[model samples]
Target: MTPPLALYIHLPWCRRKCPYCDFNSYPAPAAIPEARYLAALFADLDADCAFLINHRPLSPLQSIFIGGGTPNLFSPAAIAQLLNGIRQRLPCSAAIEITLEMNPGASVMAQLPAYLAAGVTRLSFGGQSFSIRSLKQLGRIHRPRHVLAAVRAAQAAGCRQINVDLMYGLPLQTLAAARADVERLLDLSPSHVSYYQLTLEPNTPFAQSPPPLPAADVSADMGEQGQQLLAAAGLQRYEISAYSRKEAQCRHNLNYWTFGDYLGIGAGAHGKLSTVSGGQVARVIRLAKWPQPTAYLAAHQSGHSQIAHQRELSAADLTLEFALNALRLTAGVDVTLFQQRTGLAAEHLSAARAGAQAAGLLDGGAAGRLVATARGLECLNDLLQHFDLS
Candidate 1:
């Protein structure tokens, strides 16, 4: 049997491009072309469904993650249309998790009720910080009050699963300021929190002219202190950057961590799927759509495949890819999961596992669990080197 499946939809329009973001998002125009985008997305979904029918039938979708360039820019009607179209094309559980990402502000809060009514089960806000200066430095347009109001609006709309995103290690950040952000986020009483450290990703404005952020040790301290604060508030760390209350983990991301298959739709979405033939794993395919919205739309209108890239994972590739995502979980995955997901024998990891064990990077040695030591989690890139074949 195939692993669990999920669906990912990308909306690549934001009100304004942040200085530090590296996602495939563009600034919104005065009026977004919602109808055209909706049509294209539906067409894309139809094509993928047809393709799946010829290859392998999918299991019920476990979750749907509508991520973006601030997906809140779309009207609730458009979202409803999108979700309805998906259910018509693909089979999914009635209780499948549906998450929408948005920036916290008054502009979008008024529509939260309609959005919840449209089938969004979870709301993830880009509540980057609570400090006025931090918001300005991070190039976020929403005020701190806006974050509070957004959460309140979601709750008033009867949204039960709310996630607040927080960040540490800002340019010239102090330990106290970082703690304040965590405190304010916990005060919102969200079901989940994504606490991240600011990094100057390559090709972003921050990378070209990097700001003076907290030093390495200070940034480490900031993360450590923030996790302690979150645990105290009953939101323990789950994934590397994710903390959540009991039974409230983001199911869509959990699918990714467990190396499950998923379909991708809309601009710049990526997907991984395993094809089975004769009751055996035949091949695992990775596919990505064109990143540019204009180009993607034109390709769709012309009835062309908008996929910009596709590749099959080699045995070595599968070994590393599985470890890359699974090791991110604090508790790790069962040792047998490597073979279950990749179709290769679990022993493919034996040599690399020995190397990691000798280096004190992997714990639960030679057992059912494949956990990373605290030091291994800190130097995850280094730990991944053991799995690297090229």
Candidate 2:
């Protein structure tokens, strides 16, 4: 069977990087080298295609994700050119899920129609918070009203599959405050909701000067209450931080959680692919593109990006990778899928199972899947520790 192919397009520039964000994002400059970047992006994709043409002749493109710093920063023409490049090099399926990530800031508002017409079927808005205070605290450029306006504009542009990202347990947040934010977002009736707890990641400004965030107990309460509210709002908590209306869960992410294959194309993007030959030889692969956007552009212009940074995964690597991503879902991957995806005996991770179960972090039998117990989801770090490389 031909491996499923997915493309990740990364635009590494944002209007302004948020204090809490450590993503591969940079502050946008006054003049963007759109034409140069577009040329380089296509060249990079062409190089990736040549690899497949030589070794693994895939059938057609299954999915395409235009994530960013902010894909909306580019004009529809640039996006179309990139899409056309993919179409020219490979067969693009009609059912391909083309998703674009947009920030709610006013600057991106005008590109909605062009994006929709450019074949972007899904739009995920970075509506980090509906609370104006939270927006200010997070240093978001857009206000709650702008988020509302963006959602309306996307709907008007004929985007039915919309995802609004929200955050809870923010600085000085309360359960009541968190509930109100969810209510406001739900009023927009989006197909998907991704609710993430605020984490002070290392290297982020938030980590350098830690804000007065809610306490652990308060953060937990906010998370629990937010899940309950989202469920009541007709969005099922399909994963720890993701919820969706029926058939609306993000397939691109689901592919990752289930260990499906994809090609990482842009700066800082990562991908995985699994291949089994005969009954003895199996390879579960991983790949990372270059991290610096400016460097990527330079490499793109040179006709060779050396773009792929890492591309190896041993059996144990696959096991850990599978568990790390799959266990994040509320409904975990099937037990059989563990062996199929990782090419390892599930019993190899028996210690993880026993440890998590003892810690009340895993349900002994949920769909006969190694799913996260409420406690398991909460103590994820501890649970994942059971899979240490040592």
Could you tell me every candidate's TM-score relative to the true structure?
0.98, 0.94
Poorest 10 consecutive residues by lDDT, candidate 2: 273-282
174, model 2: CA deviation in Å? 2.6
**Model 1 misplaced stretches (Cα beyond 4 Å):** none
Q: What are the per-residue Cα lDDT tens digits for candidate 2 across 1-390? A: 334678888888988899999899899899878887777777777776776554454667778999989888888988888888788888988899999999886766688888888889999999989888999999998999999999998888789999999999898888899989999999999999999999999999999999999889888888888888889989998887999999999988887777767777777877665554553226665767778878787777666754657567865676677778888998887787777666677787788787778878878867558798877787788778776554
Q: Which stretches of candidate 2 lie above 4 Å from their native place?
A: 1-3, 54-57, 276-281, 366-368
Q: Best candidate per TM-score, number?
A: 1
Each model's lDDT: 0.90, 0.82
Q: For model 1, what is the error of residue 328's alpha carbon versus the real structure, in angstroms, after optimal superposition?
A: 0.3
Predicted candidate 2, C-alpha RMSD = 2.0
Write one digit per residue (lDDT tens) for candidate 1, span 177-296: 999888988888999999999999999888999988999999999999998999999997889999999999999999999898888988999988888776556788898999999999
As for candidate 2, its clashing pairs are 361-376
Clash pairs, model 1 backbone: none
In terms of lDDT, the best-performing candidate is 1
